[model samples]
Target: MQQEKMNRSLTLIPVVLFGFSFMALATVFSTYGVAAEISHGMVSGSYLLALIVMLFTAYSYGQMAKAVPSAGSAYAYTQKSISPYVGFMVGWAVLMDYLFIPMVNYLLFGIFFSAAFPAVPSYVWILGMLLLVTIVNVKGIKLATVANAFISLFSLLFILIFIGLSAKDILGGAGTGTIFNLEPFYNPEESFSYVVAGAALLCFSFLGFDSATAFAEETINPKKTIPRAVIIITLVGGAIFMTVSYFAHNVWPDYTTFTNADAASHEIITSVGGKTLASMFLAVYFVTVFGSAMSSQASASRVLFAMGRDGQLPKFFGKLHHKYQTPINNILLISVVSLLSLFLSLTLVASFINFGAFIAFISVNIAVIAYYFIRKKERSFKGTILYLILPSIGAILDLWLLLNLDIHSKVLGSIWFALGLIYLFFLTKGFKQRPPELHLGAAESS
Candidate 1:
């Protein structure tokens, strides 16, 4: 019997939910302190700047999704438009994002869950989350998407509550005590470099929008839906991040006074709503992280499936479940790898994930230029501006962010790339020919 294929059952709303969940509605709480410190309390401005940079990249992803609606995402875009060799390397780089992000999400869940229930080991929570996400993914895309949508809605509710409480506290003569203030956007003490550095880190919250493209093969009317979803998710997610960060900044205007820079939002939560609400916020935050992990695992499995089907990795990774029509092997692989969170430090894992994401962002931006301008010679003024000039700017911004990564991340990312190089050597038989290709069905170019 022939193996089952992924069900083309996902629509625009589910896609949007998947993207939103992957971005994680609770992201501000986890990263706000660091962003505030880096930008000298200009956390809102940093997120806005990062959103601008991400929008440009989102355009490239949108254009590419229309051009090549395949599950490989950046890999498919690069392979079809640029060289297959480059595509393989891009796929390798993106694998780091897909493979490790879920781990990060689960690691975060573990930490918070363990905190809530101190008697339980963190690793136990991690394992339990891993199991739940894996099972949801294996069941099918629709189930996973529904789970994400529900979790996303609850997460959004909690965020709105947090913002409302913060606003009320501000009105009650706390911190700035007024929503109208430019202090969160700028301060004389903060330099341009500091804001840019903060923006680089803030970009992490926007990472999941691109992963939406990985569902191309499983989306209904993918060429149109995936592109629109990519842009919409970015805009929506950016709005949430910016608004929350703005109020959060108002609640605690002094970055230097944070007891733990990494846990600044914790203090803000307690101040705004007391310990009970803070505890409730933590529980909701865990749910959001769980949603994030589920979305990440689903996306990562599809990328592995795409790569496997194209013969970049073992063909087994390409196989869909006989009954469920999901990427069973690849999903299982990701679950196994996510176990690394048990042993790895959160700081190292998060930094390395960002490194891979930045590299992949650079590749996707360049792929837009190479394919549309250089290869196709579609030099119409609009095409030139959108496909060439915009992506160039995105690439430059991504490069700047890449430079801002810590040395440890830079080194580890380099090592991952080196391993990819070694794998490519054997896969291509010493670079004598192109890598194997998978036939994508019914791709419509925009």
Candidate 2:
């Protein structure tokens, strides 16, 4: 009997929008205060530097996606191009990211909404966000893409409004009283190391670009479309971040003056755009978080489905719903896991996700060199640069960021890695046999 497959209904446009959903444009404001503080008024430069770091890994991901267009993403890429042991470890590590992301958004939503309505319980909002994302995802990727499209459009519109308002205010004797200024990008008083530190933190804002690769099976053309979508998502997301951060830093020249760094965007928005725009920012930001959670949940489920189908976890997880042809089992499991947010704090959840992400980034870059350069022997000068030099830089950068993670993240991440290693030993029966994997003769799609 033939295996059930994903619906190949996604083309370039919807795919891009789906990626946009994950890299929500509004995220610039979400972390603006802390990033601004770290960069010392050079948040835009930090974001620009972060973008350059991510692009190299993004390119490596594109190459791997072209070679192995599997829903498992970094996990599957590492398994095929490098050691299966390493691939399993990569997947296990990134599962920390894919799994916790929705919970992070859910936690944030609950905290924010509950604050506004005081009467409604925060758990209610958290549950609602979870159900909304789960239902949308379970229905199908088609429905999810439609939701993603709408949210993506709204994000773009909101950013444009912000830029327009910020530019107007700056021109009208506000915030340095000029649109063009170097302070937002460079501060002679601030050391460049500060920018790099801020870049390490800001890299989380660009997480969604590679998540595009998770939908390879559902895409119309995995090889061409996924590659282009990954690069485009990175560039577009980076452009939005730099532009937004530039204006925001200029608008509020004194980052230290924020009464509360956590909610600093609220102060800036209300001050510049007034009460109406402030209200609009909150409302639209809520929706953007919803869309992002939905997108991340969907990606997480697909990754689980890929692993289960390969016999790494359990075969039942591989089974798609007969009607929707979607990973309903995995989706539900992720939703259940998200309930942990009720017990977990936002700071702890957010800290460890970046730890897993950068590890996966480093793995992919190294995989490019191992598979293309060493294994395949693509040794021309161009291949050397593309497959070796570029990926080495990417790996080094990823390692630097990984090391920069807070003590909390490093401690938690190390525990998670140790657990995965232990599980790998049992799964392979003391390393005597290979972990189970299913290699399809051809890619599957509708």
Using TM-score as the measure, the top candidate is 2
Q: What lDDT does candidate 1 reach at residue 79?
A: 88
What lDDT score belongs to each candidate, Candidate 1 first? 0.87, 0.88
lDDT of 2 by residue, 1-446 (tens): 66547888888888888788887779999899999888887999999999999999999999988888888999998998888888889999888988999999999999998998899999999998899999999999889988988898888888898899999898888887878888887889889988988898899999989889989889988989999999999999999999988888778899999999878888888888899988888888888988889888888888888888888888888889989999999999999999999989998998768888988999999999988999889899999999999999999999998988889999998999999999999999998989976464576221
164-265: candidate 1 lDDT, tens digit per residue? 888888899999878899878777766877777788888888989998999998898998999899999999988888899899888888889999997888
Can you give the lDDT of residue 412 in candidate 1? 92
Worst 10 residues of 1 by lDDT: 437-446
Best by lDDT: 2
lDDT score, candidate 2: 0.88
Pairs of colliding residues, candidate 2: none
